[model samples]
Target: MIKVSVLYPNSDELIFDKEYYLNTHVPLVSKLLGDSLKNAQVDFGLASGVPGEAAMYVVMTHMSFESLESFQAIFEPNSVEILSDIANFTNCQPQLQISEIQI
Candidate 1:
């Protein structure tokens, strides 16, 4: 399994719309990634620690590294288009990390 964890730094003005993100933005990305994607998770509405940190974090879990490959292959300028859909709500770049599950 491969997990891509994105930590969003909270900002005063950039706080994401929880329902919009959950209902719209997330589904857009998930749809692009396709049904092959699995264990898709989104977390929001959290208390901030640092003043500059984002108010939310989103973690995407692929069934395996294979899914990651599929995702990257399709990633491109279209990514920018897709990103623009949610850009206004987030201030930090998605810090994606792929890690193998040891379980």
Candidate 2:
């Protein structure tokens, strides 16, 4: 399986709309991606390993797919709409990573 991680790094100046992300953005992505998306998980970071450090990211979304081709087929087509929705939620530019999921 392939796992795609969308990470929103945390910073002192960052603004993240967790409510919209959980309620609106996630569903929008799920609806757009359809069956090609095997599973989706969202994480809200609370803190870093260090006691007083802020969490690395404010939010991270993990998506599982059968293959990169399958993910791209839907993502590439609907990316415009999906990306545009970000402005309605947060101003943070998300970081992305793709990896192979083992077991």
Candidate 3:
């Protein structure tokens, strides 16, 4: 399996609407991606390892796919529409990474 990680960095100046992301945005993604998306998990960061440290990312939405082709097929066609939805939820720019599952 392969995983696509969408990481949103935490920022004092940025605004993220958790309610809209979870309720509206995520569902929209699932609907658009369709069956190509095997599964998905959304992580909400609370803190770092330290007692008083900020989390590197406020949100990480990890999506699983059977293969890169499956991911690309959906992502390539709908990237514009899907990506544009970000502005409705958060102001922070997201970092994206695609990784193979070693374990």
Candidate 4:
């Protein structure tokens, strides 16, 4: 299982639209990839420590690499739109992290 982590840089106004993210955005993402997407989970919150430093939120997605390459194929192209929906509550660009399964 690869953990796709997204770090949201925050401002005093950083907040996640749980309703939209869980209901709308998540569903849209699942549909976009069709069967390739599975066991989806979207996290919402300000990153620890960073919140005091500046403003940082995070979303860590645990997905299978094989099932998520569809998003990768168009990552750079549709990134803005892809993230815009979630960015509605964030203050800065999100930091992303992807790790290969080590176990």
Candidate 5:
């Protein structure tokens, strides 16, 4: 399996619409990706390892798929619509990463 992670950095100067992301954007992605998306998870960063340190990211979304090809086949076609919805939520430029799920 593979996991695609979308990370939004936490910053005092940046804005992240948690409500819109959880309510709107996440559902949109789930609908668009369909069965190809094996599973999905969202993380709201609270704090870092250090007591007083802030979390590195405001939000992170992890999506699981059978393989990279499976993800690309679906995601590529709907990329425009999915990406365009970002503005409706927040101004943060999300970072993306794809990793092989071990064990």
Candidate 6:
């Protein structure tokens, strides 16, 4: 499996609407990506390992696909719509990573 991760950095100026991301944005992505998307998960950062430190990222999303090609097939075509939707939830510029899942 291949995994696509979107990481949102934490900052004092950050303005994230978790409600919209979970309720609206995620569903949109799921709908667009369709069956090629094997699985999807979202993570909310609470804190870092250090007791008084903040997490590096405020939010992280993981999406699994059968392969990198499968992901690109769907994502590339619908990228404009998917990416444009970001403004509805947050202003954070997300960092993307693609990886082969290792078991």
Number of clashes recorded per candidate: 5, 0, 0, 3, 0, 0
TM-score of 4: 0.61
Where model 1 places Cα greater than 4 Å from the true spot, the runs are: 45-67
Model 3 bad stretches (over 4 Å)? none
CA RMSD, predictions in order: 4.3, 0.6, 0.7, 4.1, 0.7, 0.6
Candidate 6 residue-wise lDDT at 101: 91
Candidate 3: what lDDT? 0.94
Candidate 6 structure quality by residue, lDDT tens digits, 20-85: 999999999999999999999999999999998999999999999999999999999999999999
Give the candidate number with the greatest TM-score. Answer: 6
Error of 4 at 37 (Å): 2.1
- Please provide, for model 3 over 28-47, each residue's C-alpha lDDT reduced to its tens digit, 9 standing for 90 to 100: 99999999899999999999
When 4 and 5 are scored with TM-score, the better candidate is: 5
Number of the top-ranking candidate, with lDDT as the measure: 6
Residue 78 error for model 4, in Å? 5.7
Q: Which pairs clash (backbone N, Cα, C closer than 3 Å) in model 1?
A: 9-53, 9-54, 10-53, 10-54, 10-55
lDDT, candidate 2, 15-101, per-residue tens = 888888888999999999999999999989999999989899999899999999998998999999999999898888999999999
lDDT of 6: 0.96
Error of 6 at 37 (Å): 0.6
User: Pairing residues by index, what is the TM-score of model 3?
Assistant: 0.96
- lDDT by candidate, in order shown: 0.57, 0.93, 0.94, 0.58, 0.95, 0.96
Model 4 clash count equals 3
Better of 3 and 5 by lDDT: 5
User: Could you tell me which residue pairs clash in candidate 4?
Assistant: 8-57, 10-55, 10-56
Candidate 4 achieves a global lDDT of 0.58
Error (Å) of candidate 6 at residue 45 is 0.2
Off by over 4 Å in 6: none
